[model samples]
Target: MLTRRRFLLALVGQTILGWAKNLFAQTGVFLTEQEAPEAVFPEATAFERQVIKATPELREKMQALMGKFKPSIWEDAYTTFLAKKGGEFLGYAVIVEEIGKHRPITFVVGIQPDHKVHDVAIMVFREPYGGQVKERIFLKQYRGKSVTESFLPFQSVRSVAGATLSIHALARGIKKAAALVQAVYQEGKEGGW
Candidate 1:
């Protein structure tokens, strides 16, 4: 036996879900309303309103726009989401997990699809000294290069020479971010990923 309040609440949830489905039918993305438990990926729990919403129309668009990338259906799914929401896929956040290109510390970064970096937020800094590497002075170097797909060689490409650890941390974060973007791009390759 359900109470009237419980029945109304269930109805509201279903309505919201239906509306979400319809919105994604047109847009392919939904801002996550709250943080999530650790399940989607490491260090990626409780993010800003950023989530994927897939639709038939969105999938088709991703297939056409990024056909050359040879992405999988899943990638298409994500890309479709990004493109439909907006061509840049800006504001999608990820949690930094490794210490490649940098050493002795791991940090968190916020990035956009067009490769635009939002913030190089340091979630954890286990380094010697004042942790100046935790500042944007080193991380800001990654702005605009988020779409490079692969780590740009320190030379030939612009970087903050002064902040070595921070620069490397940003680079490593960028590299990780590029992999996510590339993963979605590659997903349209043929099968699903």
Candidate 2:
């Protein structure tokens, strides 16, 4: 002889228990739907801003790598990178560390002065697993490409002996990493920064 109120209570109780069990049993990773709110960053006088959404997978992968190396990047040393409230930010760059076939590779890429390879620096293209990337002929071939080349026909790019695969991956990673920088640079240039 359950009252109507009692029946409703029991239903709620069961639902709560079921939800708890499901929550506790889930072993897979949890993905955040939206990124947390960002802290207030400094503003510029005339420079426009370009912001890109950071995918959860990309964020996680970066975090995992950062945790493993606990490395200190240049930005980390400076503490802040916000431009002054004037048209001063003509270019910006991001530091990305990628796990290549051999070892971790770090590089700097931003909008090029002439638009091809844009101001890309070899930085630390360290590899731990292979030696082919250390070849001179392979390294010299990357000097002339313009950012406008688009790197579409990757096959046209020269390949290193045993380092072909790693070089390709590293090159692609550098391009992807430069995307945000390019956006910001365009904005800054448009805004007269």
Candidate 3:
């Protein structure tokens, strides 16, 4: 026994869900493997993928280092690419995805060998409100920032007027990725891991 009001509500809910699914499907592979390397390392002649597994000890250390936990972006393993030019190391590039408002935003972050951010590019931005995050003015602020820097939204990191959440999520994701590289790749390599 379905009331008219109940039927109408169900129909609307289904319609919204279908629309969201279609939107997500359309955003598949915003940044392909070929393009990511080029964007992260414009002068690189080759690149290598290194997978860092997040063991229990590693996860605990990351949590301590970041001072905050974001389960969505922090996974059990991360695939980071090392860009090289004629056998000389150029830098590192990592792609991270974080929840923005109701959907996910994917971006690629490039870090120099000195641990400073070289650039950040928005690969997939699903939220319609914060498309401005892709603008150079906003993304440029992240350049030269490192894991040692404070990435607090509206504090160390400037926030967009209408895209506060997106900005915060991007900053946080970048910080996490940088920290991962520092703790796992750089430090681990030095420690003879």
Best by lDDT: 3
CA lDDT of each candidate? 0.43, 0.42, 0.74
lDDT of 3 at 189: 56
User: TM-score: which candidate is best?
Assistant: 3
Q: How many clashes does the backbone of model 1 have?
A: 14
Pairs with steric clashes in candidate 3:
none
Model 3 lDDT per residue over 155-193, tens place: 677777767878777877777777677777777554211
TM-scores for all candidates: the values are 0.41, 0.42, 0.74
lDDT of 2 by residue, 67-172 (tens): 3232222122111122233555433333444556545555444433334433333445445343344344544455456543434225546555555545655465
Residue 165 lDDT, candidate 1, scale 0-100: 42
Question: Model 1 compared with the native: what TM-score?
Answer: 0.41
Task: Give the winner by lDDT: 1 or 2.
Answer: 1
Collision count of model 3: 0
Where does the lowest 10-residue lDDT sum fall in candidate 3?
22-31
